[model samples]
Target: MRMHTRIVPLAMTTALLAGGTAAMATGAAGAAEPKGDVTAQSCYGSARNYTGTPGGPGRNAHWPATGTYAYATRNCTDINLKVNYTRDVRVCFKNTGQCNGWKKAKKGVWKVAASNVRDGAGFYIQFKGANRSTGKIAY
Candidate 1:
């Protein structure tokens, strides 16, 4: 009788553990998608608003200056850039060697900048000239 009781309890415990693990897996699979907008300003105080689907592509206003920049709101999974003038631009993870290529800027459109970036990486803009540009940025 003693051995029987011990085995029943052990089996019950195993079942409970298996159930808990399955629940955890389901929760992770249904994890919520990112929401809301992220905005970043230029070194010269130009506001670039990313008003797109959270964790998706979007647009912004004109920005000026050339330097490394990041969003102040939340972490992003990827990033891209576009401009109103012809120039070279790239986005990079802050403080890391991971970066996109120096693609030529498109006029008032969105272009692929970087992918698989660190969750909260910054960007590097290479303004060939003019020092100012307007367009969209996906994040």
Candidate 2:
């Protein structure tokens, strides 16, 4: 009957569409890696957040200047920082057990721990030495 004929074409079309959609999703999952600046904001939003530059040759983590709390202008070239507090935060890195207070820090890459920042305080890279606070960043 006419109804049966129409049903077959509709069913075939639906099946084909579904198959194509599934294939496309699978392909997307295996696409190229992500690029650009990486950022992590607080649950309450930008009030407390951090951003880092893309990894490359001799490139270290850098923070923005102003807008938010805290500041630092240092490129962490060969070190990683795990910050558990903000504004005089305690830092721990490779080869160093207890780094000096934020004020007397050095220029290098830091991987700030979001959950570690205390009491809703914002994260900021601390640039040490003479030219302190080249910049700061907020997520």
Task: Please identify model 2 stretches exceeding 4 Å from their true place.
Answer: 1-7, 20-115, 121-126
Best model per lDDT: 1
| TM-score of model 1 vs. true structure | 0.42
- The window of 10 residues in a row where model 2 has the poorest summed lDDT is 71-80
Structural similarity to truth (TM-score) of each candidate: 0.42, 0.32
- In model 1, the Cα lDDT at residue 62 comes to 22
Return the top candidate by TM-score.
Answer: 1
For model 1, the run of ten residues with the poorest summed lDDT: 52-61
Cα lDDT of model 2 by residue, 56-114, tens digit: 34432334343334422222212234232322332332232334354323334244423
lDDT of 1 at 41: 28
lDDT of 1 by residue, 1-139 (tens): 9999999999999999999999998888767433333232221123254321111123322232234365522333445565656557665455775655677767775565665665555555444443455555555
Superposed Cα deviation of residue 7, candidate 1 (Å): 62
Error of 2 at 133 (Å): 3.0
* lDDT value for model 1: 0.52
Residue pair clashes in candidate 2: 49-139, 50-139, 64-136, 73-134, 75-108, 76-108, 76-109
Task: Give RMSD (Å) of candidate 1 vs. truth.
Answer: 11.7
